[model samples]
Target: MTIPLKLHVGGMDCAACATKIENAMKRLPGVTDISVSYGQELLSVTLDEDRTSRAVIEGKIRALGYTPAGSDVARTPANDAQAATAPWWRSPRGRLVIGTAALLAVAYIVSHIEPSWATWAYVAATAIGLVPIGRRAIVAALSGTPFSIEMLMSVAALGAVAIGQAPEAALVIFLFSVGELLEGLASGRARAGIRALMDLVPRTARRLRGSEVETVPVEALQIGDVVLVRPGDRVPSDGDVIDGTSGVDEAPVTGESVAVLKEPGSTVYAGSIGIDGELQVKISRTTADNTIARIIHAVEEAQATKAPVARFIETFSQWYTPAAMAISLLVIVGPPLLFGADWFTWIYRGLAVLLIACPCALVISTPAAVASGLANGARRGLLMKGGAALETLSKVKTVAFDKTGTLTRGKPQITDIVCLAGDENDMLAMAAAVERGSSHPLGLAIVAEAERRGLDIPRAFGGSSVTPGKAVTARLKAGFVSVGSPRHAAGKSALTPDQADRVAALEQAGKTVVVVLQGAQALGMIALRDEPRPDARAGLEKLRSLGVRSVMLTGDNARTATSIGSLLGLDVRAELLPDAKLAAIAAYRAKGPIAMIGDGINDAPALAAASVGIAMGGGTDVALETADVALMKERIEGVAALISLSRATMSNIWQNIALALGLKAIFLVTTLVGSTPLWMAILADTGATVLVTANALRLLRYGNRRSD
Candidate 1:
């Protein structure tokens, strides 16, 4: 049996560290799969427990110079963040950098005082910092990772000292330590941005007790309990407003800059601030089920899945590192042996080339941009499953939409009532009784309409039968009642020309017309319309501007579907069953990668069939579980926004790659010619890492866009 293991990993600064650990762990017995997420600091492994155990895996991670949850290493930057608000010099890694600087300063002053003691002084300074780097390099080598950045740094510094360049070696070690400190600071900043989501929900709440409000922890707030939201306080949980009115700022959870007005019966999300008037809200979900918690979970899980471009770069780097090491070695020995060149000068250039060989900048290029993109999407109420989904969405050539919900609002309302034989109220009451407990959207709409009109609904006589995608039927005291699609009623008997004309007019008007029938006699028809979402037209236009096509695939009748699709200028494929929807998706795949957007149980098959599945609303559990991407808000614009964001992320990744390689390529040329200084080489490598991370951070602004 395969067992899954999940653990928090510490001290991994970039994707290179993750790749190193993955390579070493994959060589272990019974290790079926291993994934290390650098952005999330999480390790997920699948293995056969009979052959190997958690203890062995964790031990291997520790051996690779990373701090696993249970294993304590000599120094961990993750441990250093316990006083996260403190100055950088106070952390353990910070202290090392400070201490090393002090030693280098002391050695420099003494060397100036006595020329004879210069060599020994610099050697002493180099030894202080080299001890830790050398230990890490040796540990990494034994664990099957022989060419890590630490190994390159250690080898370069040691080789310099062996050539009687103690002063230059000391300077190299000092610069390397400072470079490491900068990397930690930058990586820590990015990680903190992701973790800040958890802090949005406050710890405590004000639960109402009779006439009084009592302070309590948010965890103690139960479903159906009303909590008071004072002005300027964030709502403690997902709930509905039951009292008062206020302009609530939802920017914290959903990136809208404007405040949303909250009134009675309005649904409010957790972590949104109530700006003006105080309101009492009834809790709907526990904290873990709220928007903030779910978004955090999604981002963390996404880090485990790499994009195709990322995979290619990682593979390229695996060979690139060893090839670089060979070239560095040739620079040191080849020229000196063949052309009788100056050995000392060639060796100095070789050390500079070694610094350029560290793959930190190249390794981090894609994941960094992806991490920022995920964060941006989360803030905008877009939840993509992973890097792969984010990348695939950008390639989508056509977006197929489920008409009832994706483009139109999923909520259907009663529009028109036609009377044939009985009074409208009496006929509606019969349909409502049969649909009283049905969870279907159409049935619920009927029940809600009947209740709103103050009709008296009698009890259903016996067990009710449902036609999967059609309607419901049950026996009433007078006779049998059936409320379903117009086609379902038409099959039983012929409709009068006048009645048929009315139904045709309603259906042509883009309304869903259902026949209310008693046995074979048609009593009347009810027309329900689900209007197109406010952003439907604009969003589709934006998609077209990006060179993507739009299509509507629905189970709705041809007239209704075409009418609705024409509103947004979309291609219509109407009257599709669930199987047909899946077939349509497979056919669309032949044109190019397609995305299916939906919000219902039947849409699941099509969602799974498409290259990318986007769930339209946050409320549907089936869509949430099955779709590759989910929009927490009903804003259709988010679909286009996410695709635009994905394209921007890919563009950002290419820029990072060019920068990482471009800088290294220039340094490599200069190093071979003995022109580039050793310090400048190490400085460029560290600078590249920080610069790539900083560039990725630019995507954070996407979260703050005023509107989609």
Candidate 2:
């Protein structure tokens, strides 16, 4: 019976790391299935119940220079606590172990000694130095599968002993161990990126109870609980500020380097640091529901979903391993037994062939490429949820964009406020007072404008109501004050012939006019417009260059959408409602894979429906949650760059896979056809592994040309 277990692993930095962990685990005795993801810092292992223990699996990871946390086996409290901390590489012990292993390997490799002596020395040193750290590998190999990299290595070493060639056997084990150690270190580096993200969420929060501060675990924080946040402290949960004020540095959360000034009633997210001042925030979400938690969960889920290419390798390996073993047996015993010739020499040669046919290189090729691609993306602020998403992104043919925040900046400002009847001050004052009680973006703009002009806004009058796409109505001392869309007010006979012309002119300029009326008489109008992002045009062109069709979808009128679309050189402009946008995405997906880029609550449904959804970092929670990929920087150019990077990554992965498999196939054939020497087989296998690894690492240097 295969028992599945989830282990929180540390020191993985990329998809390659996940692959390395999986490969290492599969080499264990009872491991039936294994999956590791650097994006989530997790390892999923399926093992035979009677053969392997959780301790054995964990020990393997440690030997590979990774820290395994959260398993069914015994765990130290300190280790569990540290699991909630920063990147694994930041830990003193993990660093020390990696540093020591690396130094020893380098020193041993550089030493000028006889091949036989050097081999034994390296093997002995690595076993002594890394075995204690990587006990999981030994235990896993011993308990479950009778054949593994360790088994092959041990056999090869003992074969030399059996033939009085102890030095040769030792050297073989040593070089192989060094290769394993190097692979583990690379994996650790890749996993560290995900761990860094997880570390952002504070483990505890300071709750306020009637002026007394009480420290409580973040998980215990409930909605509506007041939490006191001091300067330089990380916000423990997402909430609204009910008291105090501060400038929050949201760099870690939004990837924005600047500190945003926040006041009373402003929303603050978990993982953001309080740059200055104190704040008493009323928690609006639980720890599990917080933004950081959701991000972590999404990343983890994505990592678990395997890529199509990876799945192929796993399926192929099932038959490949058994077939290779059988072939080795035939070459070793079949011919000599049937022909009545000496078996010892041929058997020894067959064992050498078996050692070289481990398929370690082929198994590792695709994953290393995936890890490298993911890591490169992270450095450029593109957060792909997993290997599956990363693979899908490279194949996107058409991309749909949500207008607000996706193309145009989500923030709409009051560009011009005109008062027709009453004085400018009085007109502005009345409009701001009525809008103050509303939460709409337009309302916020009005309030912000009033505050900018140093105008004091009175509380909302009694019986205030807001109508979407229309306006706000308030019962005031003068009479009924209606503030809304120009068309709505015009329909109510509030606009004069001249005022109507002015409205038309403003509409032509892509500005939204809010008409303010008192008792059916026009008072004034406020003009607002969503600012186009600076990089929108350039990004659209770049996407076009990449052979991706760019389409703009907006709820605004056709003229407005067209005007913006034309400016950005978009191929299609669809003035659509929220449902229409979702339908549009569906329509496009019917043709082929489509990527939807959006950053608003309205875009959430469409994002979820698209083949791949990309969210702007500063977008709404709904958009972020729905998006498959999140770009931390809110620049349109980043989107194009991400596409380019994804394609580059996919190409690299395929190349590595081809190279590894091609080499393995050729070597296997040569061994079967002739008397393949032990040294030659070892050299070819190790050399091919190194070549694939180096090729994958080239992805790290991607985009360097542009920088240069």
Candidate 3:
């Protein structure tokens, strides 16, 4: 069997580190695939276990001069605190800080006491400060990527020292180290946000064991265990309330600010905080399969998939570094050989060109913003799959929504009652009694309405049968009662003009008109309707504000669909079956990228067919699996928020790209003129990287405009 291995690789300071690891691992005979994520500090490899062992993989990683931590090595409080207080020399950042400080101290002392030895003092500082950077450069070169940023920095710093610019060279390495430290910290922070999601789950859970409460590790929690939750504590796992009642705050999982009331049978998720009451929850999911776990897993998986722009940038970077190297070689050899320029001066200029062409900032421009965007969306109850969906969402010109459960609450309610002959109350009571044993949605609506009106609903004399989306029938006291579609109610007899007119009026107003019949005689009619969500209009208006057109696709009849569409000012494609909905999505594609938002069950096909599939959180697991994005809040406004975040993220990515490329262009030109100093070139390169990273992190603050 091909087993997957996940390793937490240390000392990966940049994207080039990931590339180098991938290149080295691909040479192994049994390794079929290798993916290293600098943002996550994770290396995922697929290999035949029989052919290659974990020991072999770890050895290879060690040989490449990187520490390999196993997946089981979790970041606990003790370990985290220890890491925080570790010695400065132990970490790459600390080493750089110490090395730079020592070099500066040596330079100060030598310049004051033995001024003639100042050059040697700076040279010694360069050698010490450049160790970490030089090691990575050599590893990358040996791994077949000769034009990594480390390589460029190493060459530029060494060339400076060779030209008798030891002080400049030391300063360049110092600044470069500082930049690498900043990038590492930024990348760590981004991954930490994702890791913090796991932290939200309590490590210990109070399990109910034979009337006594025992504290146990969350990992030991099993399905069907009844866990006791007290006030102010996070629910330990995904479960249902078996006893007691309380208000559970599910913001960590659903992003809903308000705490939902949980009573017996109400579902609760892991990471929800209990407030004001105690409840015993029967675990439905194990600790590793909780909602929070799925979300964290989804977000990490999403980040692994590259966005279109990120892929383009990755491809561009491959050629970009080699092109920069070629340009640098030309600057060194071309100027002197072709124009009789001074060799030493031209060489210095060429090294400056190399420093300016590191491409660290450019290579990271898209993924950084993309990673932040995914995290931002995840925190806000929006689950966008990856950069591809995030980027696609921004370009979607049209959004198609499933009407039921998406635009409306999906719960049908009794709206009207018309009596042609029998008493209105009597007829409704009969209808409710006939549907009492039926599990159909409309039947449930009728039964609920009867109970609300205090009607006496008698038991059916025999078993009731239901035809989906049509009718329900049962044996009653008088004879037989069949509550169903208007056609079914008519049953070989035409409806009176008055009855027909009443049904037409009700249907025209978007109500589902059902006929109550006894044998061949039509008794009366009852109308039910699923009301539009309170925020539906406002959410659609937000879409319009963003210049995205909205359309409603529903399986409802034309009259009902039109009424709802007109009410919300949306373009309507009514009476669409699941296949028809998919077909509509196909037709919309001709106009532009179309986003299909649905309840994620009945709409799964359509969701998959659209450019971007958005699922409501309450949707089935299959629907969630098929969707590219999910709004856990089940709000139409989530569409607007998703688009807003995508646009902001794409905008942020472009800004970083422009900033990196713009600064590099200016410095490259200045370096060729011999006016740009080595420190300035190094500073520009490092500064651009820090600037772009800071800009990308701003996306973590994205907010929702409306509630679901």
Best by lDDT: 3
In candidate 3, the residue pairs with backbone N, CA or C atoms under 3 Å apart (3 or more residues apart, or in different chains) clash, namely none
- Greater lDDT among 1 and 3 belongs to 3
Q: If scored against the real structure, what TM-score would every candidate get?
A: 0.81, 0.72, 0.90
Candidate 3 local lDDT, 677-701, one digit each (tens): 9989986778998889888888886
**Stretches of candidate 3 exceeding 4 Å from the true structure:** 1-4, 46-65, 71-90, 417-434, 450-500, 514-525, 577-579, 704-708
Task: Indicate the TM-score of model 2.
Answer: 0.72
lDDT of 1 by residue, 370-462 (tens): 888888787677888899999998889999998877788778888898888878899999989889998877889999999999999988977
lDDT (tens digit, per residue) of candidate 2 on 1-708: 778888878655434345557777766788876767665566777778688877888777776656786765422223434554556455644454565556456546745555545655544554454443344445435545444455555555556556654344544544564455455555444444446656777878999999799999887999989999999999998999988878998877665667988789898888889978999999998877777666555555655566788778866765676676777778788879898756766666666777677666766677666766666665455667777778888899998887877788778888787788978877787788888767788888888888999986656657579777787988766677878988888889888899999998888877888988887888899998887798898888898888999888777777777767777888555657777778888899999889988873556788789988888865246535657888766778877888888888789877877887787677666766665655556655566667777777777678868721
Worst 10 residues of 1 by lDDT: 71-80
Computed on alpha carbons, the lDDT of every model, listed in order, comes to 0.82, 0.71, 0.83
Best by TM-score: 3
Model 2: residue 668 alpha-carbon error in angstroms: 7.5
